[model samples]
Target: MPSQTHPIDPVRYGTEPAAPARPIAAAPSAVLSAVDAHAEAAIALLSDLVAINSINPLFPGIDRAAVIGGETRCTDLLGERLAALGAEIHRVAPDPERTNVVAVLKGAGGGRSLILNGHLDTVAPFTPERWISGDPWKPTLKDGRLYGLGSTDMKGGLVSVVLALQAIRAAGVRLKGDVQVHAVVGEETMSHELGTSAVLEAGFTADAAIVVEPSSQPFPLSVAPVSAGNFNLEITVRGRATHAGNRGAAIRPGGEGASAGVNAVEKAILVVQALQTLEEEWGQTKSHPAFPTGFFSLVPGVFHGDAGVPSVGYMADKATVGYLVWYPPGDTADAVKAEIERHVGHAAALDPWLRENPPMFDWKSNWPVADTAEDHPLVRTLVDARAAVLGPIPRGRRETWSLNAVTDASFLEAKGIPTTVFGPGNLRFAHAVDEHIEIQDLVNGAKVLALAILGWCGVAD
Candidate 1:
């Protein structure tokens, strides 16, 4: 008789068809049942997390102390739940009050660890009166959507990680490699003092990481590069205080005893006109290769006038202005900065008032780029997992787009970790009235994450 060869089980290197060399020791039924049993608790934890108002300090009246207070509550709650799951937890804080919580779930076998990252802080809730249906702090479930502040932006993603781990624990499904869940603060505002940067410095490393940022429907993962910057300028014109009645005489070169001098506001208009011309020319030339050809944008956001009070007495002293610049992934921050300075310098030389009070420019603080090759094992695994769970992934993609207004992904990416921003929900709803996450999308995200984690750790079945 010929000897027969048996097929190998990918998940468990075992000769027996149903058995593995290293099984969880618990039946599959038992593991799944545990997950099902704890599903309600997992949802409850998310509900509580959303209930806490952890708005960023960039919002009006939010001070450092208030932000810290919110961070403490969020860390405390996550710590309690993670500790119960048998994970070793660490709290790192530059400030005594604000903290970043890290929970490590050790694996039975050694392999590369995966990082599950989420931000605890969110943008401020818009005016309560503006809410269309539910309060920002109080979460409401209606028409299969969970509505609350941070519901889609990220609280939902954080909840999913917690619940997935809980189910794994309850079912006694031993992981092949470790998993680290990091809940961080300071995503909304650009703050170096306390945020993801702090966590990285505290010595947190992972082979790959996922940032649970909000996404549009059909569950598209963001793998595009995003760049942001800031600029400022000032203009001043020379004019003499004079009576309103004498304004016409001031305009005349040599009128009968002209008391009024040149009108400062009039000169300011000329400077603004010159600035607009420069803006149009610069806007057309600048482009980034990684992003769409016209992805570059500039906006004049702030303007200040120095006339003492609103009353029109003498000519205005000066006019100050500030703006923002956004470009595509491959664009260089230093180049953009140089271009801005050059334009401002040119404008100042031409205009006399502007020459006297030249424009001042300041670039936005450095925000690093988070880009990993599409062929990277971690990136490919996530792309495949998302496709399996949510259908065909969206097209026209690069590596890194706007993760949030500005997230620590940039900070962490600087430290040499491949990171991608992925999650469920419409980005439009984030920070808007009646923010929410569709239940189905949230479920799909959790399933996709679990499968991706399995693939990354080489778990097979």
Candidate 2:
């Protein structure tokens, strides 16, 4: 059922700021009531967003022809819906046909501005047949959860933001500060250059931001004010190749042992072992208040023997190892790199071959850290909204913690805009075969976000 809204008064709702809101003495009952009425509409919008095949084309092994331009269509759809609700829409395409939409809904005036951020891009569904519904794009509602691709990782969060704006409009509520919704592309690749960072670089800014990333710090969602940083590290080791028949000479005490062939894979293994030892050291030393003890870790993701053309009769000359390293927000990428390099360097020194030919490193695609204070106004406001919407919740749900995964929130926080991650859904389902979010959770998220908006932006009296 739609709530009746009186025509907005121009004097109260205008392009310019009016005056700062006085101390909020009463709750905005109308906005909360409107969000409840349109609760189902939030689920419907999530279904629509999930149905779009907006898989990022930049992903490895993705068929560009099948998913290249889907993001543009999403932007178009979001633009139309927001425009109809009196928002000014801006679409950013850092790459061709890959668009990020920023919709700005003006406020009455003199309130803190806010940005609600979400990514429109999703990873391709590699195992679509594995989905219970048999189709990744066909939204299904069963047992109170909406199942579909991007439904959790974050079409649900995006839908919550849309519902918040819709309810505010439907209730004829004009905020004192403007609210901006940034639906971005390329997040699946962490290509912030073409997504979240690009939006800010293009001059779309606010006093604060909320990245509605899936926040299942164990169910019902937690407010995450910090997210660990990560980097893709590739290490290459070199060795001298020789005929397989020289194996005996390579290791024998007197059979040209120093001059014989060296195996790169074995040397790479030493490096990996040394790094594992260093990882244990990190586990003991690197710690943050917002994260679990020993949360920072170095994980080896891929390994390859440098054999461009295989000839089994020969000793391998080179090898490469790929690693994903997660570091605490309190540290810098350069510092972590130096630490690993120092450890590896010391380990390589004792080996005769490695001493002369050291391992090479290539750091790629680093996601920056996000560390907003828990007591910041934006976070405090979100806590207030959460408490009011969900009475007597678990301490973890309202307290700030470090998200185990990184998000575009890093970009916003890096740019000095205080930001936090809070929304509905479990991360285990984000990029999994059967992604979903509960309908009740979705409704509750929308309600909470609506009030948070009013709390932060204030109401013009």
Candidate 3:
């Protein structure tokens, strides 16, 4: 009889079934439990972050101490905590005193990578005296809420991300892919060159990302898959200068320069009226399911009359009006700008004096929209994880929505990395006096982040 090959030793046969795959060590319940266990610690970290006045110095009337050292204080605290967790830290100062903390938890490889991003800066206290809750920097944990500056805008969200990683590590689960937590500065000032944009430029890339902006409610469109784009425009209206006393004579029935001068302020008012009408038209015509009605708007934010023009006596020869335009994805800044220019041209054509001196437009800045499909895997993972953590969705509440304002996530999405927004706290409270976040919201957000991490990164066998 021919010697029988050992059954255990597989022969070189294509028909043989492949060996069974090894199971990942991760358990959803275990991870969730770990996150719950560490909830207090997460809140503590947030509390510490809140205690530091990391107000963006760009704002006027910021505390001198915060301007000099607040950002560094917050960054140092974050660095210490991340280091204790064994994450590799990459410190970046994109601008002077603007510290960014990026910590990486390397995985065993072969799985998708992810980035959890949050801003380190908060708007300066608009009116510290109006803080009914307490001091903006002296954070307080009271009545199920953590109250202070930056608590809701994003510091709390950042803490939750760190706690989620800690929970994963505590559970002894090894991920197959990398996870990066980036805490950047200058977000409140919307300086892409120094905030998340700088982080990406420093070579922190990932397969997908989550921008932890406050979105605690489970309303329809709660998870922001898209955000409006923005741009600033300055229109210069030029007119012949004349003394106020002589203005009437210049236009006295074809006075032919008898009217001492044309008033640019008057022309600017016409432009404003036209723009208001255009805004209404845009409201009726352009509607996104995720955004509120008339999400695309042109806001006149500032107006400047000619220098040295007295309030009563001078007929202003030059005036400047600034507008901020919010448009949806696929809407080009140039196109919006062109439309505005056309409106100005139309208004000027109707005015004999303005026909010769058409309004001149200067673009200040432009940013594109960050958009992701609701059905994208990243979004699905977040929705599922949120549901798992927060329970069933409320009736008639949309699970996804679009942000009316832009975030640093826009930069990540622009770079081709699919991204979505989710976090804890009431968005209405962000940047408001005595901003605060609910303690339970923090815990729930951490749990969801942990679950999402496990689902996205996968576990190493």
Give the alpha-carbon lDDT of every model.
Answer: 0.63, 0.83, 0.78
Superposed Cα deviation of residue 369, candidate 3 (Å): 0.4
| Preferred candidate (TM-score higher): 1 or 2 | 2
Residues 66-91, candidate 2: write the lDDT tens digits: 78888888777877888889999997
Q: Scored by Cα lDDT, where does model 1 land?
A: 0.63
Per-candidate count of clashing residue pairs (backbone under 3 Å): 4, 1, 11
Cα lDDT, model 3, residue 156: 85
Compose the digit string of candidate 3's lDDT tens values, residues 19-59: 33223233377777777778777888898898887878776
Provide the lDDT at 262 for model 3: 79
lDDT of 1 by residue, 41-132 (tens): 76677778888888875555677556557756886798789889998999988866677899988876766678888888888876876665
The 10-residue segment with the lowest total lDDT in model 3: 1-10
Error of 2 at 150 (Å): 0.7
**TM-score winner between candidates 2 and 3:** 2
